[model samples]
Target: MAQTISVAGLRKNYGDVRAVDGVSFEVDQGEFFGILGPNGAGKTTTLEIIEGLREADEGTVAVLGLPPWPRNSRLLPRIGVQLQASSFFERLTAREQLQTFGSLYGVPAKKADAMIETVGLTDKADVRVEKLSGGQAQRLSIACALVHDPELVFLDEPTAALDPQARRNLWDLLREINTAGRTIVLTTHYMDEAEILCDRVAIMDRGKILRLGPPASLVRGLDAPTRVSVASGVLAEDEAKDLPGADEVSDDDVSLTISTRDPSAVVAALSARDALDGVQIRGATLEDVFLDLTGREYRA
Candidate 1:
């Protein structure tokens, strides 16, 4: 596949704080690329620079083989954007909003309605923008971005503030959109969302990308031990140490956390003694890998 976007030695500074420092990455054509990080991690700054909304202090950014800076006229029509919050005419109906946005791109009103249907807001097509719920508003924002049928889309925290069900619904819509062949670059603080949606993700912090790869590959490279939690610490230190495949155990009298690569062996040891109540075992995850690197998990 061809490269859709590329950033090299990207740097941005705000007085004393280096917002984006020496970052570089390439997004493949038609790939669902994600930037995952905690708040204040320079994710938005990096994205804005690539979107041509903000100029970097230094470095190079290219989208579709054109410089994104200065907001190139030739490039704008090929790019779509959905920010964390999108503003629209309060009195305009959902369908009307799309038509208005499409007009800027020379897209006809009929095309606008088709885009609205594409985002699944046809039922509320005539509803005013203000009357729409949070999820509905988000769907409308996506429709507006897609009104021109742009080749690449940038979504900043698209599912933020939505309930679980609404978030899942948006996820389904996003998958459908990607399946139709539009490349998507998404920035999200939710690790699970990135893991599920992104073909590859760049984990960033303090203006730097610490890791870049598939979520499964990143987790697998950790070489970290599996974690097992039990309801109570019934086994003594000596006993737990002798259990098959048990590497480490932290017992607090009220709960037990065992670290081991062979979870089944440890579970078998616990269950054989009728001490398996509330037992839970988990392998390493993206969050765990992040915690190991930064000593903190991704923020909301």
Candidate 2:
């Protein structure tokens, strides 16, 4: 498959601090790729370099096979970018915003209007930007980005302020976009969103990618323990420890929890003991792998 975006030895610095350090990655044509990390992890810096918004201190980037530096006009029409903090033409209606953005690429007014419905903003088309809720404004921004139907799109924390329902709606819209052969490069802090939407993800921290792969594959590589929980007193803490394959066991007033590598063995033992009441089994997730790679310290 052809490459939509490519980066090699990408580096960027601000004053004495290195924002991006020797980062490299590629986004395949029509692939849903995610860059995930905590705050100030260099995700935005790397994305800016690829989007031609900022120049890299070192390294090369090709967006649609053309260097994305010095403000490449040729690449502008082929790519769409949405920042975490969406900026709109002040006082413009949602419909007007899309029309204005589409006009930049010579897209027709009707086409831009259609995008309003695509992003589920038809009823809010006449609503002024200032009157819209955060999630509603987010939908409008996304519609603006897509009104021109660019081949590649960059979304930075697209669902950041959205409510759960709104976030899931946008996810569906994004899936449809990728299904229609548009390449999407997304940066998000939501591990579940990346795990669900991205074909592959690069986990970054301290200006470098620590792990890169499909979410499931990365989680599988973690070999982390599975957690099994049941109602309190379903089994004594000592009894859980004696269960086959149990690595650790703990009991709170509300629940008894067991951690084990062999979930099947633990589950079988629990079943034999008739202690499966209110059972919940959870395997490792991308979030677990992310924490394992990035550590638990909070990032601002």
Q: Clashing residue pairs, candidate 2?
A: none
Supply the TM-score for candidate 2: 0.98
lDDT of each: 0.90, 0.93
Candidates in order: C-alpha RMSD to true structure: 2.4, 0.9
Q: For model 1, how big is the CA root-mean-square deviation?
A: 2.4
Query: Considering summed lDDT, which 10 consecutive residues are worst modelled in model 1?
Result: 291-300
Please give, for residues 1-300, the per-residue lDDT of candidate 1 as tens digits: 899999999999999999999999999999999998778889999999999999988999999999998988999899999998899986889988999999999999998988888888989999999999999999999988888999999999999999988899999999998999999999997888888999999989989999999999999999889887787656676777788989998888777888999989899988897778788888988878777765664457
Q: Pairs clashing in candidate 1?
A: none
lDDT of 2 by residue, 40-145 (tens): 9999989988999999999999999999889999988888999878888998999898999999899999999999999899999999999998788888888888
